[model samples]
Target: MIQPDYIFECSWEVCNKVGGIYTVLSTKARTLQQQFPDHILFIGPDLGHAGQAAEFDEDTTLYADWRRTTAAAGLPVRIGRWRVPGAPLVMLVDYRQLFSHKNELFYEMWESFGVDSSQAYGDYDESCIFAAATGRVIESFYRFHHLESQRVVAHFDEWMLGFGLLHLRKYTPRIATLFTTHATTIGRSIAGNNKPLYGYMSGYNGDGMAAELHVEAKHSVEKKAAHFADCFTTVSEITAVECRQLLDKAPDVVTPNGFEPDFVPTPDRYPARRADARQRLLRAASALYGQTFDSDDTFLVSISGRYEYRNKGIDVFIDAMNRLRTSADLPRAVVAFVLIPAWVYAPRADLKATLEHGAPTTAPLPTPFLTHWLHRMDDDRVSNFILHAGFNTTDGERLKIVFVPCYLDGRDGIFDTPYYDLLIGMDATLYPSYYEPWGYTPLESVAFGIPTVTTDLAGFGRWAQTVVSGRDITEGVAVVHRTDDNYAAVVNESAGALLSLMRCSDAERSTIAAHCQSLAARAEWERFITYYYTAFNHALTAAARRADA
Candidate 1:
């Protein structure tokens, strides 16, 4: 392993916690921290997202001299430690000042690397400015620290930070650069815009599709960075294919995302948390539909992530629930929760009042399925789909669909629990994604000892097939075969997976859950981090060769 003396990792999700990249970096920080100590640093935007930085324990005095020096140089940064399990050093850069030079930076990017910024719109300019500012911070830090002789690796993540990789390549040629694209811009755009991505993936010209999807500026920068970086990497084998087809640059390495096992509660503490979570979830469901449910008899299942109706398979999940509702063979009552965030106005006051009353409810609340009220209730895809499926009135339904349309960060008022706390209580989890790159939610579900159902189209599902040597939901994960046109079949298979799980005896369920957890053990960072080390070595060796030349 060619480890660096200093490693600088940059991402738009360092402390912001918007998406899966946040999970990837935060979970892997401790292992890296153990090797590098304070030499490893993470750089992120200082957007001051209210209480989002709770995990960031700022220590201005730790890097006082460098902070003053960078301040003098007009690059404001707050030095801190990410209060995750690893507590690695973190630097949140204030990139607002760089917005003034956005045009000049874009012009230079176009001139030096052919990153087309002409068609940039919306948050593109903001993200580009942040990326440029990240480059500036690293350049300043490297010089101030006077580490020209030391081997350094700078890893930039996703398309959001692609411009920063270019900035590093042009300005800091000695620094080994690795760029990892979790998903290609044009590929996700094609899937989101209702195009057949998998079927037409081979024939689609990335540049042509970028123009067709109006993602030229983003696609150009990502492609250029992939070409310029010392090493180009992605998170999964499936996404590597997308990079080859859509980004037009096959990755040098595939660093599948890994999780820290420490995040899971200890076996001693598990029972209480699991019971409390189940009670809270059951109580909330009871209050929503005004129906009392037996905690032991109720089977809790959920699908949680960013709300993508087709892409994340909300439509298919609802369809399966529709099938489960009418299936007479189900032995127990199942409560399905859609724990995805939407444009919510606030938590429902009536539900809060009902829960606080601590009384069993037999009268349903108005718009009972949703835990939170959305600003665009009429336009919300999940709610509209469930409504169309006749789930608006689920009082009589055995398979109850409850929509918790808010971030479950232990503060959603109803659950008052983080995602993993509730996730551990689930009997089964479903993430039938149609356009998933790595499928972290399903992976996470299995890690928590919950049998999960996912589609082969997902990278995690494909990986699970290799690990278990076959497709069996009973082996802790059910990898359903999905394609661009197998919508109905996928739905039927997903519903069948749930039905089979419900039919399992207690002994069978225990065996299956244990198997799922064992599979998750195979995906731990201890096993998966080697790929990253290989990628790091690739970048460093290439950079060394270039320096010698």
Candidate 2:
């Protein structure tokens, strides 16, 4: 097997928990550590206030010489260990300095690589500036250590880091470059705009769609990066199709995301941990609704991810919950939580008071469905949907929907528990994603022995189909067939899947939970990390050929 002496992985989410990419890198770090040890390094944009970044443990002594030289040469960075499983070495670059050279960098990219920066807006400039800075940091370190002759790999994740890969390829030609697009800019935009992405994928022109969706600059950079990188990869086969059609480049590898099981409780302690999680979740729901829940009888379900109403199927999840409420055959009282983070203003004062002290009144709180107060309460889609759907915590209702607008970082006032802690309590999870590159929520749910319902539209859901047959929750995951025009059918199928889970006998439920764990075991980093090694080898061989040429 071919191996790089040093690997440098760059992503916007490194040490900064924004999305699923954070989970990917953080979890994969330990496995990569086992293979590469101190030879691997992660690069990320500094969060400005170092004190605010709790995940980074700065170690000034580890790279003092390199830091001093890099700082002297105009690039300042914080050398540290990410507070993840492996505690891998990391460099948080202060990319703000590069903003001054934004135009120069963009022009250089355009002139050299044909990366069109003329129509860039929003986060394009910020992302590219940081990406270019990462390139410079890698170049500085490579030169500082005289690693030109050594086998080295520079891996950049997502379109946000596309410029970094291009920069690295241009400046550090000896370093093998790999670029991974979790989801194509144009593909995501097409889905987000309510277009029939899958149905008309082949007919869609990447550049034309980019112009129509006002994502030309991001598409341009992403497409060029895919073509320029020595090895280009994506998270899943579904996304590989999107990359081929939308980006005009087939991925060299489909590097699926994998979970690190270190955080999951041991078999001996899982029961107690699960019980505690259930208690906390029920307590929060009870506080929000001012009604105590029978822990044994209540079925807990959740839908969480980025608050993309249509793309993440937040709308479908809400509609499905609404459908469940009207079902006469509903086996148990359902408490469905919308755990997506939004512009949370603060924890609900009344909910907090109720959780701290006993509920003064048994009646539902003013907005019985919300656990936290959103900044724009009136305009928030989830809040508006709950209101319009007439969802309520009525005394005899069969279903209750609670929207948690805050990130569950264990300090979000209410739960005081991390996301994974609460995740273990879920009886089932639903992620009927319309455009997920790789759905992590469903995967995480199953990893915790929770049966999940996702749709065929998701990359993870498709992967699940390969692992197990049939669309049954008993098989650990139920991948409902979803299409652009099948919103109603998807909602009904999701509701049916939840009902099926709720109706499972104790023995059957236990078996299903075991199945969930068994399925998740197949997706561990130990198995999936080989694809990354394959990508590294491809990049290295390509780089060698470039050198020869």
Candidate 3:
């Protein structure tokens, strides 16, 4: 292994209880340290989130002069650090002032541009002051580690730290810069502040919200980051195609993201582990919602993701549930529809209300994004519609739809919740990520020893088809192809496949789940993290050659 001496990173959600970026950063911390003998300094702006930083130990006092130096330089370092498993060095770039003021700056930019997010997407440009200061702050931290003459490399993930690369690129210790766009900023930009259910779209433009600010021309941040860094990447292969076409830069390599397989037990060791996971799910469901449910009596089909009603095929799922429930000669199966949607803060008033009212629609749910949040909405009326919708609760036939709107701490929620147990017990995982750069949830659900149904648009689905012994068009976890001329036929066929698995013998289900888990392990982080090290090495080798020239 060509271990580098340093690795620097930035994340807005590093300390904040935000998105998948936290999981990505925390997991990589220890692994990067193991590879780098000297230091793998992680510099994320803390805001108030620094207090909740995991792996936190007792605080050490920093000299006022050094703190003042950071503040004077505008980086405002409030240091609290943690060394995760397998990491060599630990450094927290806690900047309470800068982080806390992000909202203020977001609005200031909006006001200064004379436009509001209500009309167009809101984007806070941090390529200037913040990047400049953070670059200096990181430089100081890096110098301390490289005093022993360490080969240095740095990474800036997403637009949040786009400036970090710009600031760090010129420094002598800056061996290589790798920029990754987890998702296109321009893609998220048009969505403005819309809820996931209401996916926002704008005509393709690189300038993005900058157009509202009246910049003469437009450009992609992906392209900008590519130009700034020595190498660039997206989350998956399909996403790479989109990036190349849209951003005008092809990623050098596809560093696919993966879940830690062992995080959730896969029942390969103990045959009864599946039953135990199911029992746990039942108990948690009863405890959390005051409703008794049996794992056998309940057939669980879940939709977990950012709730893009169309893109995620949330519409298709609900419709299929309705169709499946009402089919003739079909046993009145006790089916539970579980949606642990991301962006729960977005208003789901009408969507949740319709479920409450038992009013079904063939078309998508009639709700727009940017609606304020409404939670704790389970009333007797909603519960009644869900229970009495069509099947028999009296003799083992009913459809149960549960919308869990809280944060799923990997350890507590699905990760550790009866959720995985329930997954192991479920009929199938439904993932119709219409625009998935790559889908992790379905891949993960399978790793929990449950089969999944994903669409072909995802990078995972494409790869799994190559390596995984997939379910036939009749019974295995399938990737639904939407572009087929017969869309209805394809969907109906997938529904039949799902229904068969739901009614399969216990032994058959276990066999499929085991196969799925084995497929995922082949692509787990053990193989994927090597990509990060390799990508950095590629960039540095190229950089060295350039210097010699």
Q: Candidate 3, clashing residue pairs?
A: 30-86, 30-87, 33-87, 33-88, 206-219, 207-218, 207-219, 277-421, 332-397, 471-476
lDDT of 2 at 434: 93
The candidate maximizing lDDT is 2
lDDT of 1 by residue, 1-549 (tens): 788899999999898777789899999999899878999999999887333544598996877887887787667899889978889999998888777887899999999988898998877988888888889889888888888999899999987888788888888989999999988998889888888989888999999999999999999989998999899998888888899988879999998988888888888998898898898898898898888888988888899888777889988999999888888787788899999989989889999998999988888888888899999789888988888888755555787889999888888877888888899889999899999989899989988888999988888988999988536788999998889999999889998888888888989988997898899999999889899889989999999999899
User: Which sections of candidate 3 miss by over 4 Å?
Assistant: 1-3, 15-17, 49-55, 58-90, 96-134, 146-149, 170-173, 187-220, 266-292, 329-332, 341-397, 410-427, 469-476, 484-490, 546-549
Candidate 2, residues 1-549, lDDT tens digits: the string is 578999999999998888999999999999998899989999998986545564788988987998998898778999889999998999998888788889899999999999898889999998899899999999999999999889999999988898888888888899999999998999889998888999999999999999999998999999999999999999999999888998889999999999988978999999999999999988887777777789999999999989888999999999999999988888898899999999999888988988888654577888888888888789998899888988866787879998988888989998999999999998999999999999999999999999999988898999999989747889999999988898999999999988888988989999998999999999999999999999999999999999999
Question: What local lDDT score does residue 301 receive in model 3, on the 0 to 100 scale?
Answer: 71
Q: How many clashes show up per model?
A: 0, 0, 10
Which has the better lDDT: candidate 2, or candidate 3? 2
lDDT of 3 by residue, 1-549 (tens): 454666766655554445556656765665565665436666655444524545444244743456666667556566545544453333345444465565554354334332232332233343323543466677765554444355567777776565556556556424677888877654444322232211222234445444543331113334565766777877887767656655667888678876665456533643576676556544433332334566675666766666555555565565566567666645534444444443345434554444345433333332111112434433322223344444232323344345454454444323244344445655577776556666777876777767788877677777777774444522345877654133465457556666776676768876876777777777777677888877887777766665567
- RMSD of each predicted structure: 1.3, 1.2, 7.8
Q: Spell out the clash pairs found in candidate 2.
A: none
Task: Score candidate 3 by lDDT.
Answer: 0.56
Ranking by TM-score: 2, 1, 3
- Candidate 2: deviation at residue 293, Å? 0.3
Better of 1 and 2 by lDDT: 2
